[model samples]
Target chain A: MTKQDTRPRPKAGPAEPDRPQRRKAAAAYPYAFYLPAGIVYVVIFLIPTVMAFYFSLTRWTLFDSTFVGLENFADFFAEQNLSIGFRNTLVYAVLTSGLKVVLGMLLGVLLTSRLRLRGFLRSVVFFPVLVSTVAVGITFSVLLKPDTGLVDRALALVGVSGHDWLGDATTALLSVALVDVWKGVGLATVIYIAGILSIPPDYYQAVEVDGGTAWHRFRHVTLPLSRPATYSVIILSFIGGLRSFDLIWTMTRGGPGFTSDVIASIIYKQYQAGFYGLSTAGNVMLFLVVSAIVIPLSWFLGRREIA
Target chain B: MRTFRRVTAEVVALVVAGVVFLIPFSFMLLTAVKDSVQAAELDFSWPTSWPIVANIAEVVSARDYVLLRAYLNTTVLTVGSVAITVVFAAMAAFVLQRRAGRIGALANFLVLSGLIIPPAIVPTIWLLQALGLFKTMPGLILVEVAFGLSFAVLLFRAFIAGIPRELDEAAMIDGCTGLSLFFRVIFPLLRPVTITVILTMSVTVFNDFVNPLYFLPGDENATVQVTLYNFQSQYSTEWNLLFMDIVLITIPPLLAFVFFNRKIVAGMTAGAVKG
Candidate 1:
């Protein structure tokens, strides 16, 4: 414990003002308080990030490495699955984030409205968010097994046959995206509900005074005011979808010939195959992609938020 | 008549959302209590006889009680990480809020970047290996705290801004200095946000899968999420046991969420909504 001496020293110089001395003393206190967290964060997180940049440029193993410059990046880029992985990553992010925003807003509005059992319904929707993603992935994989599974059984009752949801290349990524939305939409809805409820009733009353219909009130007041929540949902879900791995790994393992693979999963695959340096590069690229999108989008959203 | 129609419409919407959200969980529950023969069918039919106790017994005791070990390991990891995260984040956030300087601004940026950027896993593994902490519980605990620190710090900073600086001065005037002033005067005032951080961070760490998988790889260090991998194999067909495993692993956190539902939701959305 590096305890700072807190005893006030006798003033030696009369020219030094008390306020400046106090400010200096207060400044030193913050650094002391911040030291534990700063040291842990920098050592564990920041250093590894810097090390990743260096390691990404080397052909490394557990023991030794040779400088490979941009070869690892080139190899990662030239891999046959890279294009599909990139496309799938974008598609998955857009699909999940879009659906989460739309569905979450609708549900948020409904739950905040005069709905029966709204509390219970909110709990039910949020229950899955607490469950382990791997558990959800496993449970959904079994349910959507296409044959003799509960989902298919329910579909069959409607005279519809079910396909192998997780097995089919065409529907694999889409199906997983839907599950991602399912497991996640609860948080989005909660955020939207908070956002919507925070909008003063005066806004709605103004529309009502104008003889606005429900649609008009919603479109004119609720939708625009809830932009912050919508922005958050899009950013959170989109970044989550881009970096998604656990559920995909548990559910499909990026199977059906890399049709459903994202960049993160691809990176994991490289690591699993002992391509540590290549995977480190992949990780860096994933970070760059996420930062590239999120930072600018946040700035754009922040600007609009203020305006 | 109009009121009746509106109520009916709301009812229909609630039922639809409820069914969609809960069907998968109900399926998991139904499958977990059935015999192997029935579980293999994987339909929504009621089990002829409930074997929940038997299934739980077998799952808990399987393979040298590995699931039980996983439960213990996960509990330790969650508690350890949450304690560290809350304390460190609170201390840092307290300072960052009270003192705005260049270092504070840089710290804020680093914290925000942690939220936005995906962690580079391979290099982290190498670093951990170099420190002789790889594949160890402490290593995984440190990783969890590092990852969760950013969010906790952000939440606390938001909450701490509301606390006045006069309290600090008042405490200092009473001869309560650095650590004592924080512990005696400041930390107790941060009760609401502290609970929020504790519950949220605990849940996050408890439910985390990737960090545990990558950092702590061996069976001895298996967390609850890693135990799911043990339940599934390339050709295994024991759906009943598997579902039972899922149920057991899910119960603790699920109950925590249900009990602290409001706090968790408030804590999670606090930053997004307010900031």
Candidate 2:
């Protein structure tokens, strides 16, 4: 409702004498159009983010605060699980993003090829992406239960023994990361498919004309051309890996002694323990870590993308 | 031989993919119908007795019909948030795409930050409490909209960039000023992207567990996902009832995917592919 064209528009664009001022006032793109979204975003998102910075420096309940800077940050870093949480976050991000990049491109290539039941196969791979994470976590948890679970049972028939996937600390983080990939690789595949499909036929034909085999065509053509898709997948899934809480919460609760805990879960557990100040600090740390990785990566990716 | 090999590879891929993805769903469906003790085994075996109807009745009727309330709450949350997300995101994206200057660049930065930054939860809860929206549906709805806006804005911007500026010029020349021009002309043309936003945002909000859990706590106000989480604990040993709840809550997305599969896939892929 606060949307009215009152402010003077910024002076830019071509200096055409034929341009009319009234045309600039077109409703199709009003400064007021940004108002509704801007207000909600500022109030609900941006303001709180700023407030989180202040509150992270304070030791207060929802009601009152005592400004206790640096102490909360120190405690958060000093916590035993902090290192594991940070390390696991990196491992999970790298593992999921790395695997998805490779597997998704392969599936993208396969699905796009002259193949039977490709549609069904694509849907089958993508279906898990839409399902509830908690449901998938619970299902996989049961399916991975040491010996009786289907995964172990299935492995037994092949005369290979299965370890306690989620029960052991070594495998807990790895198992959850694999499930994250399973739930996500569909998306990466689709993105890669789109990227791969967008490449003109000339590129592949050129490769073939060079006496190149299918491997040469794929290795040379498909992979490099899909840089944008790879960037998209890496950032999306990697950030997801960094901030993931729900699946980890549902599956392990960061258990096996918090071996599988990530930054987001650590924040949640801190909050659950009523460590409001510490939790806020944890969130700030998480934001920094994510921005640290993503900002530079985006800069690097964008630099390459433009040239 | 080449054709045979291609077909053979396709068949093999389908089989492997089918088993990997489809088995979990089958297990969820099968386990939901079994009796408690039998369900606890968590094997892939079928139920000895089909108590699906009875199981559905119990899960629905459990916790003083909280699941029913949760379904209603979730429906309202999804509709309210997705509706706002579509309209607001489209409007903002329209402006940002058309007049992308300094302010637009700043706004874009904020939007991108929303995607990567893990929201500070305790502070969010504190702020919501100050606004008297804490543990309330409207508050949670706003939270969802806030979180959803970035992706929605990006998607709409990509789609709107494709809409010709000539339409705007023509509309403005006809005495359609400000909101009127957008409402009459540009907005109508945004149908494809709008549907994409609606379906994808609907799924995101409906399946959202964390926000509702953090912001809208309490029994009566529980979202369907929160109910699923709650049921997981109370029915920790009662796998049948627990999975029954999972199946119930999972139906909405399943239905959405089945019906609007193309739009959902397009919306998700559009941003990644094009951008």
DockQ of every model listed?
0.71, 0.71
iRMSD per prediction, in order = 1.5, 1.4
Cα lDDT tens digits, model 2, B192-238, are 88999998888888878889889998998998887888777899789
Backbone clash pairs for candidate 2 read A27-B178
Cα RMSD of all models vs. native, in order, equals 3.7, 3.1
Predicted chain A of candidate 1: TM-score? 0.91
> On a 0 to 100 scale, what is the lDDT of residue B165 in model 2?
83
Instruction: Summarize candidate 1's per-residue lDDT along B42-154 as a digit string, tens digits.
Output: 87778988988999998888888888899899999999999999999999988888776688899889889888878889888888999999999999999998889999999
> Taking the tens digit of each residue's C-alpha lDDT, what string does model 1 give over A198-280?
99999899998999989998999999999999888888887898899998888898888898998889888889899999888
Q: Residue B76 of model 2: what lDDT?
A: 95
**Residue A234 lDDT in candidate 1:** 84
Residue B43 C-alpha lDDT in model 2: 88
